[model samples]
Target: MSDHRSESSRPARVPEPADPPGTAGARTPEPVPAGVQMSKQSGTPGAAVPEPPKVPAYARQPHPRQPPSPWGPAGRQPSSDLMKIRPAAPGVIPAATLWSVLATALLGALLLGDGIGLNLFLVAVPAALAAYFAAQAAGRRLRPWTAVWAVGGLSLLAVPALRDAGWPVFLAVVSAVAVGSLALHGSRGWLGIFLGSLGLLTSVAGSLGWGAHGVRDRMADSRGRWGVAFRSTVAAVVLLIVFGALFASADAAFADVLGSLIPDVSLGEGPWRLFLGVIGLVGALAAAYTAAAPVRWDALTVPPGPARGRLEWALPLIVLNLLFAGFLAIQLTVLLGGYDKVMAETRLSYAQYAREGFWQLLWATVLTLLVIALALRWAPRGGARDRTLVRSVLGTLCLLTLVVVASALRRLDLYVDAYGLTRLRISVAAVELWLGVVLLLIMAAGVFGAKMLPRGVAVSAAVGVLAFGLASPDGLIAEQNVQRYRDDHSIDIQYLRGLSADAVPALDTLPEPLRSCALDEIQRTLRGSDAPWYATSWGEARARDILGDWDPGARVRNCQELGSGDQGNERGGDGTGGPGGDDSYDPYDPY
Candidate 1:
């Protein structure tokens, strides 16, 4: 109290020191809490400084809340220029734009010319263009990968070989194009590829109202104009119906002419086909657009939420590995025992032996791959030792599974050799071979960790498929089986005759009656068949030359009826239909 009284008696106030260099002026005042007030300055001599009175909340108006703005609490000042501008384009597309796109696509389809191949090429062009326009309408920029996608798309459209490469090849080409396009447009990775593919499959339905508002508004505006036209058309239609009925009643000839003009088309006829085509084409365009400008799927690349159970990954895989190992042991025994010995021991016919385990082996191979994937995803991360064990087991399982695939392939080969090759067996064999390659890749992934395994597998699978398509397996299979027939005299003449025109050239090597009969059946099948313009390839022309009007269906012949010397003659046959009388048939001959 004495110190306070003494300090209050001082006459002169001390000046505050200046702030240090570079410091901003004294910090702004913080909001004072309620019931608090600034302390009074000491008075001059005996005079006391008056304190500011506290104001009640109701009596005092709070500073008007500053309007919110991105700039700051004070908000941004208006620009000198008065014209208002939009900040940026939104991520979404407008509805009217989509309707316009759909209309453009339908119109394009109508003008693009007929045939699936031509339409496929034509539709792609407009789909890409519409996608671009949609991006612009939505204020988005073209993606960096657009050029790459464009090149790929143009290649697909321009290459006649690729276009005519059959449905499987065509689908592969389409998927590649779609994935490349999506990737260029910013989405990437396996998930992106999957999403892009899904987009292609369902985009048409998915985009049902992608940009509905603008389209609806435009329709509303046009409705007034359309209303008058609609009413007038309805009135004319009513008048025609009424008068036409009367005229029909009066003149039977007129009625007959009217009926002829209108025609009684059924649901299964041309009108339905046209309707379906229109719907299909429109949907295709929508899907293409959606695929090209898909909603963001990149975020899905984020790691999965919550780790899966450790046992779920480990226990099933351990059991599966044991099963696969056991299967491999049995397979090894069969593989080593020689085909004849195994068949004798099992008391099974050659065909039964070949057919028995192939499908089961194939299924097991598929299940092994799934198990590896699951194990990689959820295996216990308890310690380095656990991870090493899992990887070792998975890798071993994959290697063993590959052995199973090889066995399955061997079985298929035997079956094909016995029955003569068919398209189904050949295709399945190719798939199994690819699956083996993929398992080998998975083994590498297990050893080295899955850094680029998915990418490696995808590329390898794509290359394998493209190669398989180009190899013309049908032609190759026929060539091999025909040579086999020449060697063993065990060929199924009936099966050979039943093969598609694809096998005609290969069949030309058979002796007189069989060769002639096979050609005839091929010719008949060719005549009855209708290949689309896009489906025809150079191979078809070669097949036609070999067929040459022979008729297998008209003639029946057994091995003996083909002549006892026929086998000897076929073994020496030249490339021509007539058999050469020497063992000159080279099984290794590619043609």
Candidate 2:
């Protein structure tokens, strides 16, 4: 009874109030930290608790900033609108571009009727000048290096005015002009140059659409006077045609005067001139568009390939270098010391020995260059040691390959001396020499750097080709054969006969029958109706002058006899008539 009375005396236990409306179950109970105790009202009674864990300073710091995503917010794909190609700003075509197009069309109409000669130079130079002015009018600053390519292209275009060989010079001129167009903007690296040249085709096609758009915009503008001018010009043309036809039909004198004043548009010549004019107009528009907004080829950078492991990269190159060194050592021994003894032991004549391996060496030199390029592309870029190894191995390989180039050239020289100079022989020798120059450039790049090597190589090739055209390859071939004939009376009359008018002066130095035989075809071509001044070349003019005072009738009989004797010898001389017993070989065959 006393215990019960004490319990009741303990402040009659007060009941807790209920939670307010809308408050019950609204909040989740807070999570207790590890080793932290909860109140008795929230947890089981009499539960044991421990100390809380320690927090590190780094964990308490704020998070660092993150890079923005390439996609839209929350990682969605980009919007389609962003990916679409925007149309060019609405504006009329520049007046300078229009003037340029008109000038180009006029030049084409006047000059293209004649064949390619001074016409090529006149057409090409004016077009280039027009493009420059158009670029300036478009407010674009010309690149400094543009002049180099322009000069190179213009100089090449002048080849037709000088040389008579048709195909090679034509190809060189086309390549130079294309590369020059690309340079009006700018490019970097080999890939940029290649793609930029290719892009010119697309630029030309796109210009049609671009010009159409510009015309539409011009027509839509109310303030433009072009529409009025167009209508008035059409009306004037229609009225003039009606009145002129009436007056021409009324009187014979008026008809003759009208016929003289207006050019007769023949079915053949009229369409060709129109087509040429259209081509010129299209080309001018393309040039102007490109100058206004060129593709940024230099901005397109290629990421480097994966870096290679040191051993994986170095071992193969080292082996290649050693192989080249071994081959070069043998070449040096044979070239410098025992050339005659080796030839005697091999039982081969000088020409046979020279011809047998010269091509192989040339191909090897070319392949070695490709290998060096690939090595540089995949080379390790980690440390100084890797750089050193690259320089030593590749540099040594280049040096050895250069010696191979020398050997190849020496062999070609020996072959030419034994036989005679042909277009094929001279062209290949020039290519091999240019390849040697490329190797020297590579070695210099190794010592310095490779940043400019690609452009340098391209520029050198252009210079080489230009020099080749200007040097007059066919002329040189004829001169060499003439000198050879003087040295030893061995002459290939048939080969000289096949050459163009550029060889006329050289062939004129020969005696009567030989000169008559060689100049027969060329003289016939020149003696035809003379071309206009715009269509004449220096070589053709010179040929006319040289043959002006000469007569072919006196030597015709001797030429026939000489030709019959050569045919007799070819058929009866042990069946091994031509040089090196290769009777089927054509001197003009590039291969």
Candidate 3:
């Protein structure tokens, strides 16, 4: 009885609160099955302690100082975790393989394509491959329609007319953006497409981070194998260089043979070219990888505000409308008056009057477009009177802009007819045409609201430019100029002769005497026996097809014989020429 009393009386043991789940002193609760009985050794008889279910590391709270991860939410992984963990199935392409392929492509591009036209395709092929590799790395799945678009867009470069148009960079940029947007996001909404395309620039640093981590893991696993390979490769390269130099210096015949095999590598140019090639390759790879795996894009959002008050927009628009109305009246009066009378009143020549109005009117059209866009973005909600006034003002502005665009086009056409058609004049004419289309689009948007109008306009304009490039710029210019020459006999043969290989195919469509002269000049430029087979391009191939069995000696002799038979001082005293120029005077100086 006394022993029992002693056991009971010994100060009852008090349990400290068990440490909260993950503290250092916490005990892992033991698992208990249903109906299990606990002994006195347990916290309490007939009671079971159950283990807490494990939580994933990501789900668990991290250390307070640790920043959240750039890639995902867990945080910057510790060295241990980085080594043990695996990225998801997506975006896990083997880094080494991609790098090797890119390196090989860079080497191939450097070895091929001596001519500028061929070089464009060589550069483009690697660029496209890099983009595809990046898409794979980014975990983007290509859809069927997108794949077709990509194929068709790239194939344009292989077309003789399109490639020779000398707009490769322009076409490639637009097409690549279209393809990349399709891959990154299945939708082609303008905002998403543009944002995704822009995001490629920001992805470069992220790609480097991911790639560096992957390389580090690979290096750790096979350090010895890599070390042996690297050492052996370095030794072989060094030995070859030393022996080649020694043998060549010892014998002239050997040096000559070596020169034939390897070519004379300038100490300066060789390193410079190699350095530029490396820079271009790395930049391309970085861009491609970024496009494949884009991070967060800054979304397009409207400015936060209520529509602007009527006082802010109404007064200015009314004044502008009045001004535009007055300008239109004056233009109409000038049109009613004869060309000579208008020029006399303005105290300007026909050429000056035509040139001056086109630029000023074009500028006015651009400014008016900007004003209308701003009004749409910010003009306040109002009563019916206010709304009617706003719409009317906007509608009037659009109408006035159409008039301006038409007048500008007319002026430009007159200028071209007076000076002969040129690349610049033709480009300006195309712009004027696009602006007219945009004005019509703006008018429709005014009635229906402009939520997608800007994007639609951009897409249309880009497509229009691409269509023009594909149709062949040189061909268009030559056709127009040849027609003008037939009408007035005011042609600049020397300028036609000076055009790039792109113009060679087009010149074939000209009349006999002019055609022969143009072909001879172009043939002289392409004459080089050392051009590599890999440098063969669509443009050069087309030129060869048109020119036919060329003999350099015969072409030069024909040109000299033709030069002696010239009729007038059409090309100046010494047959050296351009618009109002001797051989030394540059026609492009006026522009």
Each model's lDDT = 0.57, 0.71, 0.59
* C-alpha RMSD of candidate 1: 16.4
Question: What TM-score does structure 2 among the candidates reach?
Answer: 0.74
Q: Model 3: runs farther than 4 Å from truth? A: 1-91, 94-161, 165-198, 215-284, 300-306, 329-349, 382-391, 505-517, 529-535, 549-591
Report the C-alpha lDDT of model 1 over 74-161, residue by residue, as the tens digit: 5665553212211132344444345445555554434332223334554455556656666566556765455545545544544334
Clashes of each: 9, 0, 2
Better by lDDT, candidate 2 or 1 = 2
lDDT of 2 by residue, 1-591 (tens): 232233422233456456667767654444354334444443533333333455555655699445557555864544643233222432346655666667787678767776778777776665676567656766767666667767776777777887767755686767666666666555667766766666556568767776777766666875458867778888998999999999999999999877755544456788788888888778777766666666666655567778798899889988887887898787667656544754655666555666678889989999999899888889899999989988988888898899899999987876676567778888899999999999999999999898988778878888888888888888998998888677655566777788888899899998867888889878888877356666777888888888985667766565545532333211112223223333333333443
- Clashing pairs for model 1 are 94-211, 95-211, 95-212, 96-215, 520-550, 520-551, 521-552, 572-582, 573-580
State residue 296's C-alpha deviation in candidate 2, in Å: 2.0
Tell me the TM-score of each prediction against the true structure: 0.58, 0.74, 0.63
Q: Top model by lDDT, which number?
A: 2
Candidate 2 collision pairs: none
Model 1 weakest 10-residue run by lDDT: 80-89
Q: Where is the poorest 10-residue window by lDDT in model 2? A: 566-575
Better of 2 and 3 by lDDT: 2
For residue 191, what is the lDDT in candidate 1?
67
